[model samples]
Target: MARQPTSGHEGEAPQKLRTSRQVYDQIRWDPRLDPAAFVIGYETRESGAEEIGLPRFDPEGDIPWHRIRYIRQGTTTVWDRRSRVDLLEGKRSAPAPSAQCGLDARPVHRSALALIPPREAWAPIEAIRQAHDRHVERWMPHINLLYGFLPEAAFAEARGAIAAALRDVAPFEVTLDDVRRFQHRAGATVWLHPRSEPPGALEALQARLEALFPRCSEQSTVSAGGFTPHLSIAQLRGEDGEDGEALVAEWRRMLPITFQARAIHLLSRRGDEAFAIRHAVPLGEPSPEGGDR
Candidate 1:
């Protein structure tokens, strides 16, 4: 029997086409997004090309990777300065990454991502969820620290709003001293947990975020009642709870990992469901010597 294509997908989906990253103006930055500066993901060059127009992007590069589910951005495509120019005049093809080095860079399309559910998304804020989740995952027992860094400044409004909310509580530092199992009725999660009481700063930060994006999933916010800072290891999809305990027993031996809290981020999802840093602000950086920005 032949497999019929889904509603939207027909014989073949349009290929994105191979183009120079530089010419395309579709750049990915590390940790933060600075419009004035763009970082190369991968570098490439082709023969006879005047200069390297786009940096090579090696999707297989050895960088710590995580996957994000996609959510919709507002309608209407807006272009940055460089992207505006590329669209007006058709894009030009440059040498491939291997053309310069000995590597062969192939064009690849990413898979569509599923979204995080609305309920579970915000449930992480509630204490009941945390307690049961910790029991189920096992890895939740050891979080001693919490750190959030925004990959872009656009989300500053969201992150800043959250931080302000935590102000009344006075922020506390966090330490995810170890990893533990996080379980819920839905499934098990391998996540990190805070070691000490986070400064009231965190509480206030959550308050602001909740107030600003009220419609967002409750799991998304960090309020006095909802915040438990931790690093995620993995999420389990299986229904068997017994396996969770065994996995935790084996994983607990690797305990006590620590990270610093420098900043928090507001991540935005693209049509493809890729998460991009939209905004970020430092948690511990001192203000300028003179005054404010």
Candidate 2:
């Protein structure tokens, strides 16, 4: 039962549909939209439909989506997708803590997108980072793709899109071929440079994923230089560390930390804890919609 489009003098019309499948599909496929607040209803033999609010309904038959006759996100009657009616119309009184498409918004970075080397390869990198790298306790050995990623709750809905985007990307080998340093005003940081032969695959995959969450453009090498992917292993400062130049030479001598780049990991962490894997989107193979593994 499609409802007539409400008369609007300013914004666009809400997408019309008869069932709740469309609502779930949009939440599944579109990465930019989310339901910060919602209500779902079922058709009854009586006059009005049976309605229930979210985070409150019980799944009697384990088939809630099938019974959903109509849905509303905030104040907007969300029939098909949030993109259609959530244009400042679904404004709720109390906003979501980290709503992707909610009326209330805040910067969130409890999760990240990274290319993690296999557990087999963590030995040497961890060995070096344990002593010198200051961020060892906070992060695993990873090549950061998009830090300050989408809020943790959004990853479930975004997984479908993430898999679709990486469907064609074949697994490739990544090498930490050389040692480089970024000099600061006070201290200098040394890192291992990442290289993948026929070089653009890693960077291209990064760019593609970045497009999905257009807001996480913090690490984009737009003006500074091309994407210079690196793994931080050592730090040298004036207070109490090895010589930056000597450390670079030493790491270079022990250069070429290599591993197969099979899948990209979606990582998350609890309060003040080290980040851990949430999902691994395998290259060339589409990751199925499911829980973390």
Candidate 3:
């Protein structure tokens, strides 16, 4: 089906930048910006132009063997133009790591990106998860964006890049208005449904972060609906006889939970210990020396 050209009206979608040069130009065009100060982008294609202003991007264009397919800003290549070799798959890998782990979660899943609600918000949600969840001990009341994050060595260096990517993103408020669930092999896990005022804002934020670390995508690989921003509060796969559908229905009738998502928590744990926030990078700005973590 041919996609129709939309009438460029008030509610029309913003046009996507065609090339890396154009994207760079747009950023440069802004008067309040300094070019060299910013050295970040989650997309290798973001600077794939043959110099600065190549007329067009040719997928099959003549290329060089060492055409700068990757650039590591913080000792980590945020994006690689070429696909990675997934040994398990015996082929080039998907854009996101799909074979690393499933929804079952890895036993050694150490690092992660999450939106942890304030301590005040924790008490109530904590009570709920504790009563129903079989695997709710180590985690705080939070929503997972991307799990299985960078190693501890790269984490400190990577913080600056994460902060840079989020420099212009203002804090957003989220409402845990309802309850939801994901059915696993043996049972189901109930979770808090998070929604933003404008809608899709949370999803957009997740997408941007995922672009930065495509390999840390264990949560999204098995999710057929793509990245679902959710806070798993209750695990129903154990000896408990709680009904997932019933809990979701009951929570739906209750009052919704609200919190300010002012920052993205960089959580990590070693071995079997509980997860703790190593850093909480603030939205719209780089965090201070100590950080608010």
Span of 10 residues, lowest total lDDT, candidate 3: 52-61
Output the number of the lDDT-best candidate. 2
Question: What lDDT does candidate 1 reach at residue 47?
Answer: 22
Off by over 4 Å in 1: 1-172, 178-186, 196-201, 212-217, 220-230, 237-243, 284-293
Tens-place lDDT per residue, model 3, 162-200, is: 888888888988999877776633445678889986678
Cα lDDT tens digits for candidate 2, 1-293: 33434534558765443335534434322445543366665654433466655423322222356556656777666663322333333333443344563211232456778898888888878888998887788788888787657766666666777888888889888888888876633355678888986587789888988887765554563224645677878767654345656666776787677888988888878777788887877778766554366
Residue pairs with backbone overlap in model 2: none
Please give the TM-score that candidate 3 achieves against the real structure.
Answer: 0.60
Q: What lDDT would candidate 1 get against the real structure?
A: 0.34
Ranking by TM-score: 2, 3, 1
Question: Could you give candidate 1's per-residue lDDT for residues 10-40 as a string of tens digits?
Answer: 7766434223333233332211222223222
TM-score of model 1 vs. true structure: 0.36
| CA shift of 244, model 1, Å | 3.2
Give the deviation of candidate 3 from the true structure as CA RMSD: 18.9
List residue ranges in candidate 2 displaced over 4 A.
1-107, 221-223, 239-242, 289-291
State every prediction's TM-score relative to the real structure.
0.36, 0.62, 0.60
Q: List lDDT for all candidates, in order.
A: 0.34, 0.65, 0.59
Q: Count the backbone clashes (under 3 Å) in each candidate.
A: 61, 0, 1
Higher-TM-score candidate among 2 and 3?
Answer: 2
